[model samples]
Target: MFKKTSIAFAVFLTIQVHSAQANAQDQTADIQAQAQAETEAETKTENNSIEKIAVYGVRQRLEKAGMLSDSIMKTEVISAELMQHKNAVNLTEAINNTPGVRVSNECSMCGVKRIMLNGLRGEQTTILVDGLPVHAMIAGYYAVDAIPTTGLDRIEIARGAGASLIAPEAIGGTINIITKTAIENSATVDASIGENGNRKVGILGTGITDDGRTRATLIAQYDNRDQVDEDNNWVNEAPNQDNRTFSLRVSHDLTDNDNVIVRYANIQSEVFGGPMLGNTFADGTATSVAKVLSSFDDIESDMLFEGGDVRNNFIGKAWETTEWVNTQRDELSLSWLRALNDDWNMTLSASYSDHTQDSFYEGFSYYAEDTMWYVDARFNYFLNESHLLTFGVDKRSEEMRSHSSGETNPAYVSDAFDYDVLGLYLQDTWQTTDALEINMALRYDHVQADFIDTSKPGKEIDQYILAPRIDMSYSHNEYWISRLSAGKGYRAPLSFFETDHGVLDAYLGFEIDVDKLERSRSVTYALSFDGEQLSMTSSVAWTQVDNLAMLTKTKKTDETDGGVPLLTQLDETATVTTADIALGYAITDNLTLNVTAERFIYDTAFKSSYAIAPVEKRLTFYADWDINGWDLFTNLVWIGARDLSDYGYDGYNQIDSNGIVVASSKKSTHAPSYWTLDFKLSKAITDNIDLYIGVNNLFNYTQANEGESPLFYDLDGGYDVAYIWGPLRGREAYTGIQATF
Candidate 1:
C-alpha cells in the first residue's frame, strides 16, 4: 500500500513539470511575435504617406499603404521592378504568373498565345496600352508577343466583367499597360542568353529638355529562339521565333496643368515550326511547289483507324503540312490632357494602327491586312467635394482584308470586312460619406459591320447595345473594406478572320450570315483587410453569357455542292464563376511573402460543342528578399486538374462501319495537375549597374517529353494547339546585365 501511493505521487509531479515547460515555450513565442509586430508598426507609421505598390524589379519593396487610394476597382499592379526580378521576356510572360490570369497557347506552329481572365476565353478580354485602344480584331491573336517591357512603367490587371469601365468588350477582364514618362535623362541596356538557343537584347533611352517641359523616349528590342521537338517525333513542339520591335514616345507640357503625349511603335516578327525543315515531298524526292509535305499524312491515316475524322471534304486533296508565320505591325497614338480649371479637366486621344500577316499551315496559305483608326474625348467635372462625374465619347473604325489559296478547287478567293463603332459613356462617383462611396456608369454603343466576297457585297448589319455598371464600396476603418459591383459587357459580330483560317479558300462557295452580338452580365463581391504586416483581399464573381458565337458545321445548300461541308455561326449560353483569395505578409524588414488562391468553374448546355477547358483550382506563391545589395526572388504555381476532351492524343476511339464517328466510352478525361517553379538572383555592383541570373521551370517539367507525344493537331487534320495544359519547353537558364545612366 505504501509503494503504490509513492508511485502515484511521483507521476503527478512529472505531469506538473511538463505543463510548466509548455507554458514557458508558448510565452517565448508570443514575445518574439510581439517584438516583430512592434518593429513593423514603427516602419508603417514612418511610411504612412508612401504608396505601397509592389516593387519587385530592380527596386526593393517599401512598406506603405496596402491599397490604392485613387480607384475602387480591385486591381493588381505589377511594376517594372517586379518584372525584372521575374526575368520576363515579354508582356505575355510578365503578366502570366498572377492568379486568375492565363496565357494560353493557341497554335504550335506560330507559338501564338492569348491572355484570359476569370475562366473566360481570350476573345472576351481587352488589351490597352497607355489608355489607347489597339491590338483588336485580327491582330488580337498574335500581337501580345510583340509587346516588350523595355520602357514599361507598370501593368495593371482588373479581373472581372465589372472591372472594365472604359472597354465594352472586356467581358472577362482588362490588361492595361502604362508607359514610363521621362523626368530626367537616362539610358538603359540589357542582354540575355538562355538554353534552347534563346537570345534577347534591348535598349532604352530617355531625354528631357532643359526647361523640363519636353521629354522624349526611345526603345528597341530584338529577340529570337530556336524551335524545339519535345517528343523526338521530328515535329516541333514550340515554334522558332525571330521578333524585333522599336518604339518612340514624346511628351510636351503646353502649360503648368496641360500636357500632350505622342507615341509610335513598329514590330516585325517571323516564326517557323513543324517537322519539315524545307519544301520537300513525303517521299525522298525534292519538290519545290511553294509548300512542304510532312509525315503527318501517315499519322492521320493511323488516327482514322482509331476513330479520328481525317476529313478534308471541303479541300479537294489532303493539304500538305507546313507551318510558318510572318507579320508586320505599326501603331501611332496621341493624347492631350488639359485641366480647364480647378474643378474640371478634359482629355482627347487619337490612334492609328495597322497589321499584316503572311502565314501558311497544312498547305493553306493565308494573307491578311488590318487597319484601325480611333478617337476619344473625355471630360471630368467635380461638382463638389462629394460628387465627381465623367463623360466620354469614342469613335473607332477597323478594316480587315484577308485571302487564301492552295489545295482546293477555286482555291483563290478574297474576303473583306469593315467594322465601325460610336460609343458614349457617363460615369458618376458619389462619396455619400467619408467611408461610403457609390459609383455608376452607363454606356451606349452603335456598331456597323459589313462583309464583301469580292464578287458580291453583303448587306450591312447594325447593332445597338447598352451597358450599365454599378459599384459600391464601404470602408469600416483603415483596416477593413468591403465592395460589391454589377456590370454588363457586349461584343460585336466577329470578322471572317476571327473564325477558322481555312474558311475562305478551302470551302468552295461557302457563305455565312452575320452573327448576333454576344452579351454578358456579371456581379462581384469582395472583402479586404489591411494591417501593418499583413494585407489580404478576397473576391467572388459570377458571369452569364448570351448569344455566344461559334463555328458549326452545316449542310451546303448551293447548286455546286460537290459533297463538301459548310460552316456557319451558332449561338450558345455559358456560365462562369470565379473566386480568389490573395494575401501578402512582411516576414521581416527585408523579406516579403505573397500567396494567392483561385477557383474557376465553367458550364454550358452545349457541352459537346464548347471548346474551353478550365482548371478548377490554382494556387500561386511568391517570395522576395533583399539584403546587403543582394536580391533573391522565387515564384511557384500549382494548377488543379479538370475534365477535358482528349482530342485523340491517348489512342483513338473505335469506329463502326458507318461513316459516323463512334462515341468513345470516356466522354471527358481529367487533365493532369502540374506545378512550376522559377527563381532569380541579382546583385548590385554599383548604383547604375547590376548582374542577374534566373531559371525558368527549375525542375524541368513539361507536358511532353522525348518518349511522350502531345496532341497538337486535331482529328479533322486541322491544327489543334488548344489542348495544351502544361509547359512545352522543359527548362531555361539565363544570365544578364543591366546598366543605367
Candidate 2:
C-alpha cells in the first residue's frame, strides 16, 4: 500500500511541476510587458510629490501571536519571550508545554526524564545544538533538564521521521537549540527561590570587538532542589538535584562572505533519592545497614516486604534501596560557512563531547564514560532561478565503557563498545510556482559497531541503511497555507541503554542481537491559517516502527541460565497515530489567548515493561496579558487517562515466604484524567529590573493523591519503580528578580 501511494504521489508532483513550467513560459511576454509599463509609470511619477508610508512591528506582533513561521517542514518555534512568560529555566521546562510533545519521568527515585515526540520514545528523537548532533546517548538521560535556557534564542521542533538531513537516526523527530549570534554590549542576571529548597541563579552576557568583526556570548547557571516524599513512605517521589552549567559562543567574520563560529559548554550535576537519610551515602553517613534502616518509619518498614522472613532476607542489603548519581559533561563545537560565489556556498562543522557518570541503584554501583564526535560538510548550488540543490556528508562516532559492582560482588566491566556511522545525503528544493514549493531528500548511511568484553570474545556488526523524504508546501492565499511530508528512517541499535533503564547486575551481562535494525516510516499533513486577529494550525501524523528492540529476561532452563537479560528485536510492529490542533486569538491589543488539543492512538502486538504508556488525549489553554508594564501569563493543562495493563502494570498478588497471599494490588485498568493550572505575574520595578512570581501545579494534583503509586511490588515481593503515569510533584510557588544592564 505504501509503494502504491508513493508512486501516485510522485506522479502528481511531476504533473504539477510540468504544468507550472508551461504556465511560466506562456506568461513570459505578459510579465515583460508589465515590468516595462511599471518602469514608465515610475519615471512619470518621479517628479511629482511622493507620499511615504511605513509599517513597523508587524512581524514581531505575528510572532508574539504564535502565527508566524517560514519553514517548509512545518516547524514549531519556542521563543525566548514565551519561555520567560512560562517561567522556564531549562529546555525540558520550555518544550513540555508545547502541543504534541511530552517530557516523561522514567525513574521515580532518580528523576530520570525523557522527551517523547508525537508519541514516540525519547531515544528515537535526535537533539541538536546549533544544528550539530553533539548530544550523546549517555548525556541524553539528564541533559534535557541540565541545559540552562540563558543563552538560547529559541528552540525549533520538527516532528516525524527524516526531520533532519545530517542525523539519519532521527526516527521520531529533531529539536535544534539555536543560540544568539548577533552581539550587543548587554548583560542580564536573574535569581529565584521556591518551595522544596528550590533555588536558581543565572547570568548571560554578550560583547563585540571594536572592529565589529568578532563577537562572544557567555552564560552560566546554578540550580538546586531538594527531594520530596509526599506520601511519607520514606521513599522520595522526586530526587534532590544540584546542577551547574556554563556555555560560551564566539563568532568571527573572516571575510565579506565567510564566517566561523566556536562554542564550548560544560555541565556538572549530582542527584540523590530513594530512602530518606541524614546525609549522602557517598559521604559514608548512610553506607551501613543500620544507618539506612534508621531513615524508615514503622509504616514504611512494614510495607517493605510481605512478611518478616522476606524482610529478614534483605538485612544486609538495605543500602540497595537508595540511589545517588554524579555526572559531568563537556562539549566543544566549530562551524565555518563560506560562499564560493553568488551561486555556490558550503558549510563545514565539527563537534566533540565527553560524558561521565558515577551512580548506584538498588544496591548496585556502576560507573560509565562516553565519548562522541561528529563532522559534517555541506555544499549548496543554485542550479537555476527556481531550483536549489544541497549535498552533504556526515560522520559520527561514539564510544562507551561501563563497570558494575553489587553489594557483595566484585566490580566487572560491562557494555564496553564503540560505533561509527558515515552518511551521505542529497536534497533538492524546487519552486514549482510562486505559490508552491517542494523538497526531496535521500540519504545513505554505513554503520559499524564493535562490542568488547575481556571475559568473552569481541563481537562486530555492520549494516547499511537508506532513507528517503519528501515535503510539499502550498500557499492558497495570503492567509492560508498547507504542508505534507513523508519519510523513512532507521536506527542501528548498539547500546543496551537505548532500550532499557541503565541498570546492571554484578553477575549478569547483556547479549545483544545486532543482526536487525530498528526501522520506521512516517507521514504528516498540516494546514495553517494566519489572519489579523485569529490564527490556527492543525496537523495529523502517523508512524510505524518495525523490529523494535526489547530487553527480556531469559527463562531458566536446564539448557541455559535464565536470569540473564538480553537485547533482542520483537517480531511485531508498533504504531502511533496522532492529531493535534492549536488556535490563537487576540482578544485585545494587549491580551492574547491560545488553546491546543491533541489525541494519540497506540497499537502494539506485544506488551512493554519499561516504556511510558501513551496518553490518549490532552488539552491546554494559555492566556497572556500585558497592562502598564505589568504582564500576566496563565495556563491550564488537562491530561487524559492511560491503560495500565497494556504496559505490564496489571496488579499482582503479594506472596510471603510461606507461599501465602498477603495483599493484592488492584487492577487499575485505566488511570484517571487530571488537570493542572499554572500562573506567572511579572512587574517592572525599574527601567532595568523586573520582579516575577509564579506557581506550578497550583492545585497540588499528583499521582499519589489520585490513588496511584509509582512504586509497585510484584507477587514475589520484588518491586518495580517504573509504574509512573502522571505528575509526581505538587504545588510549587517561586519568586524571582531579573536585571539587565
Cα-based RMSD of the predictions, in order? 13.6, 9.1
Regions of model 2 farther than 4 Å from truth: 1-71, 279-318, 406-413, 454-460, 504-506, 556-562, 606-610, 651-663
- Worst-scoring 10-residue span by lDDT in model 1: 14-23
TM-score of each: 0.81, 0.85
Error of 1 at 286 (Å): 11
Candidate No. with top TM-score: 2
lDDT of each: 0.64, 0.71
Worst 10 residues of 2 by lDDT: 14-23
Backbone clash pairs for candidate 2 read 320-363
After the best TM-score superposition of candidate 2, give how far the Cα of residue 712 lies from its true spot, in angstroms.
1.4
lDDT of 2 by residue, 7-36 (tens): 112211111100010011111111111111
Report RMSD for candidate 2. 9.1
- Please, what are the lDDT tens digits per residue for candidate 1 over residues 546-653? 866554445445532443323333455778888888888888979888888889777753233234344578888888899999999999989887556522232222
